[model samples]
Target: MKYAALTGISPSVIAELKTGKARTLELSSAHNIITLTETAPGECLFITSVNEEDLAPGDAGIMVDLLVLNISMKRVEVTSSFAFEERERMSARIKVQFRGTTIARDVEGRKWGDPTKVEIIRAACYRAG
Candidate 1:
């Protein structure tokens, strides 16, 4: 998702972008493995996987709520349950954050699940390149 100009990204987050590696975006509670994408102020955040069918639809992908503040730099809050993890995940709101290294195109994110399927949560930013 492409974000509008004026998005605020933390300087600490910017410094890590140079590594050319996408971070493992996980929730503070479960700390489950969701996405491995390079997050930035103007970039779109995708949830690659969360384990089991919880992140089902495989590479189908999902984006968080963008809102007025660009949270690509901090932990994102997720309150929806996935297809399989409805009660465990979606029951209560959870926080999400990106970490790890740059994710490659060959990863499951680009494949595995149906790319056509998508879930748009509270995110408001545009798709990242």
Candidate 2:
């Protein structure tokens, strides 16, 4: 099994996780920390981790990075007019990259004419094995 490691924490934490500047940490460290936000119940906490390792053929000991998390989004809808006019549904996709590696991806659908917002609810990271 793999574990999540804590690298750093933000000093100026925000009521909402999305509102504050992200803190950076070294990927070689190991620790776990929980971050809280001002969102609703079941929608306010976030987590992340990091680890170090060596996988390069010659390097012998290189640190790879990994990140994981869950994101939330506000509901969206398409207006009848827009749907009829464009004949397409509104959609969004998220892509995550770590040390030049694609780790995870997700897509969500949105209404043609509705306001939409998303939250990265959870995330974790570690050195690639």
Candidate 3:
């Protein structure tokens, strides 16, 4: 699916946008907005939102890079004494969520603190196998 990025948007507003119930939006920030009127063949649309206010000066850019990296990586890993597992052959369209315990830098390409935890949420994928 093609990504349509929306930052500093509330979840409710996102839902409204997905349902085609919202024709307009009132943004409190000065960020730029891009609207898509149509998509080409074999293309799909998906909305992804991030809150710029919640991020540090350049952390938002890192988040965007992480997202691209996560999807392109196309694999999952979880390690623990009780469980250690990895998987490939998953859908190329799935999204992975990661949580960083701390950030080391206040600018672009910020480094994640030690002991960052990765949590993968189960969602619809292109293939279950």
Candidate 4:
């Protein structure tokens, strides 16, 4: 299994993401894996994920009910249940914070199953490059 502390993501929650094969995933609880800490007045350390399917559909990254911050730097760490290369494609949709304001984005991806499929999509942002 991949490291949760480092990746800021929970274990394979396919059961949580899938209700009955709907095109878009319904995230019941966006708390477990998503976390942020305010480092300064209008700055924070944010970490989240963007499933493989999200990239293909061009859907937004992790959903946030209230997101209003600028992403100075962003990095994605890909993890898979099996071979990561076997996946079709990878993508992430991040909102750029302007003037310290935020916008809401949907972080829904495609359906996934089996332990041998690429499942985990982790992302983190700390500082600018």
Candidate 5:
């Protein structure tokens, strides 16, 4: 599925992709969002990611890079986010509710710190896999 790149990226990053340069966006030692493009079979962009965001005592979570594929431009168009909670020992779970390209938002509809993002992240884990 197609989704927006959630974090506001630097102009340099956008410039790199438009130039057909391959680069990786790293959030940590373990999380990476790689940018790739195809030149022959039509212009296609890929934002491949491998990330881990929720890490806490007695629980951990992992997300294999979700492939944002066959893109045509440097910027994606939909809102997306990921968050998680520990549902078991050394296990993180995102409740099976929220899914799709949505950001956790405030009651006024601001994407502040809504817990719904946890479910969205969980869904990404499963759907991407």
Candidate 6:
């Protein structure tokens, strides 16, 4: 599974050629993984293989969420052994804050019987400005 974080100056700000909300985000500091430079605008960074032995869980599954601040520093954190019942799916709550204003959305995924086939869920950007 591949995980990624996408960041870029909002198109409107970029068009104006101003740092109205421009900032550099470090993927390693946030996700503890190498940064992926892709063509996508909204996706700026990512971490993968959270299920690997090096970072595997013992009992309960994990919860992934992105903390996006007004300054454009987006952080991805994982909480292990999060609450979940058998046959229940996993979900991520993405929160975005800009200039002290906040908005949130949820990303949901299911646990496949086969671990190898587990799908990679994306915590997309709900607001770019």
Query: What range of 10 consecutive residues in model 5 has the weakest lDDT sum?
Result: 89-98
Residue-level lDDT of model 2, residues 56-107, one tens digit each, is 1121111123223333333445568546332332221212122211121221
Q: Flag regions of model 6 displaced more than 4 Å.
A: 1-19, 29-39, 42-100, 109-129
User: What stretches of model 5 exceed 4 Å from their correct place?
Assistant: 28-109, 114-129
Clashes (N, CA, C under 3 Å) per candidate: 21, 16, 0, 1, 1, 11
Instruction: List TM-scores for all candidates, in order.
Output: 0.22, 0.16, 0.27, 0.16, 0.24, 0.20
Poorest 10 consecutive residues of model 2 by lDDT?
54-63
Tell me each candidate's RMSD, in Å, in order: 15.9, 16.3, 20.0, 18.2, 19.9, 17.1
- Tell me the lDDT of model 6 at 79: 54
Q: Give the 10-residue window scoring lowest on summed lDDT in candidate 1.
A: 1-10
Candidate 1 local lDDT, 1-129, one digit each (tens): 321111122335434443444433223221221222223343444443333234332233333322112222343355655533322331112233332222212222334332222333332446789
lDDT of 5: 0.25
89-128: candidate 3 lDDT, tens digit per residue:
3222212222211221332211322111111222333656
The better candidate by TM-score, 2 or 3, is 3
Cα-lDDT of candidate 1: 0.30
Candidate 2, residue 68: lDDT: 31
Q: Write the per-residue lDDT of candidate 5 for residues 9-47, one digit (tens) a residue.
A: 344544444443334443311111221221122222222
Per-residue lDDT tens digits of candidate 4, residues 5-97?
Answer: 111223343233223221222222223113222112233222234333333223222322222322233345567786444223222222212
Model 4: residues with Cα > 4 Å off, grouped in runs:
1-8, 11-35, 39-47, 50-60, 66-129
Sort by TM-score, best first.
3, 5, 1, 6, 2, 4
- C-alpha lDDT (0 to 100) for residue 98 of candidate 4: 18
